[model samples]
Target: MEEFEIDPQDLLLENALRVVFKAAEMLDAEALTPSQLKDLSGALRDATEIVLSIETACGCDHDHGDEEAE
Candidate 1:
């Protein structure tokens, strides 16, 4: 058996990623017009940037989760 260690900072980033993925899944990509897709892309990018900023401000490593999952 193997034991795993979890970091609080990584957990926060994971939660943020989960929220974005869920929101993206809810949107109907195919139904979006060119203009709508442009707007959605900008919104999603902004949301992700904000989350990244939060992670950085908290002094959390962005790649922390990837290392743990390996």
Candidate 2:
């Protein structure tokens, strides 16, 4: 068996990247109306906030989702 050092923040960042990439595929080479573009923008913004919440907590193990920040 092989063991490797894995940082939890790296895993979190990779997951966030996957989510953003999948969401971006929705707008790939497609003619999006203004409304659709706005919707996608909002979704991306929300995802950004969620990812940033980790930074807000200085990368603590605590989850900073939905509930108000302590």
Candidate 3:
């Protein structure tokens, strides 16, 4: 697969919108069509798979919340 560049901000925004859509479905089952929901799920998954994005973007010395204090 050919890798293409996308601004981190843009990816974050898109992922946030996907979360909103996913939440909307809980409020109203018909809020998103089946195909749209599937696409959104894929988008969310893709964003999450970027394991270093959050740490790199924020310059944090953490590994995606794995070290959160209990």
Q: Judged by lDDT, which candidate is best?
A: 2
Q: What are the lDDT scores of the predictions, listed in order?
A: 0.68, 0.75, 0.65
Candidate 1 ranges with C-alpha deviation above 4 Å? 1-26, 59-70
Off by over 4 Å in 3: 1-30, 52-70
Instruction: TM-score each candidate.
Output: 0.48, 0.52, 0.37
Q: Which tens-of-lDDT digit does each residue in 29-67 have in candidate 1?
A: 457678876776776776687676765576545665475
Give lDDT tens digits, candidate 2, residues 1-70. Answer: 9999997767777777776897778878688899988887877787787678657766567655645754
With a 3 Å backbone cut-off (N, CA, C), the pairs that clash in candidate 1 are: none
Among these predictions, the greatest TM-score belongs to: 2
Q: Candidate 1: how large is its RMSD?
A: 8.5
Better of 1 and 2 by lDDT: 2
Window of ten residues with lowest summed lDDT in model 2:
58-67
Model 3, residue 29: what's the lDDT? 69
Instruction: Estimate, for each residue in 24-46, the C-alpha lDDT of model 3 and write its tens digit.
Output: 67547657778876876776676
Model 3 misses residue 69 by how many Å? 8.3
lDDT for model 3: 0.65
